[model samples]
Target: MNTIPEIATRLASLCNEFKFVEAYIELYADNAVSIDPNNKNEPITGLHNLIEYEKRFLSNVEIHDIKVSEAIFAGSYFSLVFSMNFTVIGQGSKMVEEICVYKVENGKIVSQQFFIG
Candidate 1:
C-alpha cells in the first residue's frame, strides 16, 4: 500500500468483489474525503461519514453487476473506470459508468472523487 498502484489494485479488487465497506475500512485514512456527483458535488469528510454515505446509497440499490477497469497511476494519484448495473429501490434498473480518481498519502487513501459518465 506504499505505492499508488498497490493501493489502487486493492481498491479495485475489493470493489469488483462488492466488498466496498471493507475496502474503505482497510485502505482509507481516518480523515478521508469523498466527492460524489450524486451528493451535489459536496465533499464528504472522514472515513466514517463516507462509509455511512455509501451504506445509505447501497441500501437503496440492488447491484446486479460491477466492472472495474485496471488502475492508471500518476504519482500519488490513480484513476479507474467503474461500470455498474443496478436497480434503485422503486426505480428501474440502469447502467452507470464513472471515472473514479483517488489520492493516496502515507499508504492510505486520503481523497476520492467521482466523475459520472
Candidate 2:
C-alpha cells in the first residue's frame, strides 16, 4: 500500500501531467487557496476557480520530463521541488524549476504557494 506521502507525490505528478485547474482543485479542499506568480490578477480559489485558471494558462502548456528534486513531509504539510521542461502556448520549450509549499489537512490540500524560476 502507498503511504500518505507517496500518495501526495502521485497527486503532484498527476497535477503536473494534466496542468488542468480541475485536477488541482480536486486535490485540494473546498476552500483551498493557491498563490501563483503568473496569475497576478488574482489568487486561485476553490476547485472550480482553479479549473478556470488552468483553462487560461494550461490550455496549451505542455510539461515534459518532470523531475522531483525533493519532497519534505511534515505532520500536515509538505514541500516539493519539481523541475521540468515545458512549452507555453506560443513560446519555445525551456527548462524550469519550481518549488512549492503545500499545507494539507484531513487528506486535502488547504493552501499552496508556488515559487518558479
Candidate 3:
C-alpha cells in the first residue's frame, strides 16, 4: 500500500478473512509495537514479537465468524471494529466486540492497540 489509508483498508480486510499472521508480517514495521488485550504487562514490540503473539492467540482458538465494521480514518491513524465469535480451546465459544487502533508511519504500522469492552 502506498498510503496509510490503503494499508488500513487492506489490514481490515485481512483481519476479516482471519489472516492475522499475514496482516502483521506485511503491514507492520520491523520495530512496530502491538498492545493486545490478552497481555498488557508491556507493549509487544517488534514485528517478530507481534507475529508470535498473534500466532499464540490463534493457535488453539476456533474461529467461528468475523464481522468487520467500516474503518474510520483520521490522518495516518485508523480504527476498526470487529465482532468475533470463537472457541478458545478449553474455554467455550464466546463473542466479543473489539476496537483496534493503528498508527501508520512510513507506510507501515508503527503501533497498534486493541480494546474490548
Best by lDDT: 1
lDDT tens per residue, model 1, 80-114: 99999999999999999999999999999999999
Clashing pairs in 3: none
What Cα-based lDDT does every candidate model obtain? 0.95, 0.72, 0.88
lDDT of 3 by residue, 84-112 (tens): 99999998999999898989889999998
Identify the candidate with maximal TM-score.
1
Clashes of each: 0, 0, 0
Looking at model 3, residue 42 earns an lDDT score of 70
Expressed as tens digits, the lDDT of each residue in 3-112 for candidate 2 is 54864776666765654464464577788888888777367888677667667775677776776654788877788787877788688898978888888777777888
List clashing residue pairs in candidate 1.
none
- Candidate 1 wrongly placed segments (more than 4 Å): none
Worst 10 residues of 3 by lDDT: 33-42
Model 1 per-residue lDDT at 20? 95
Estimated TM-score for each candidate: 0.98, 0.78, 0.95
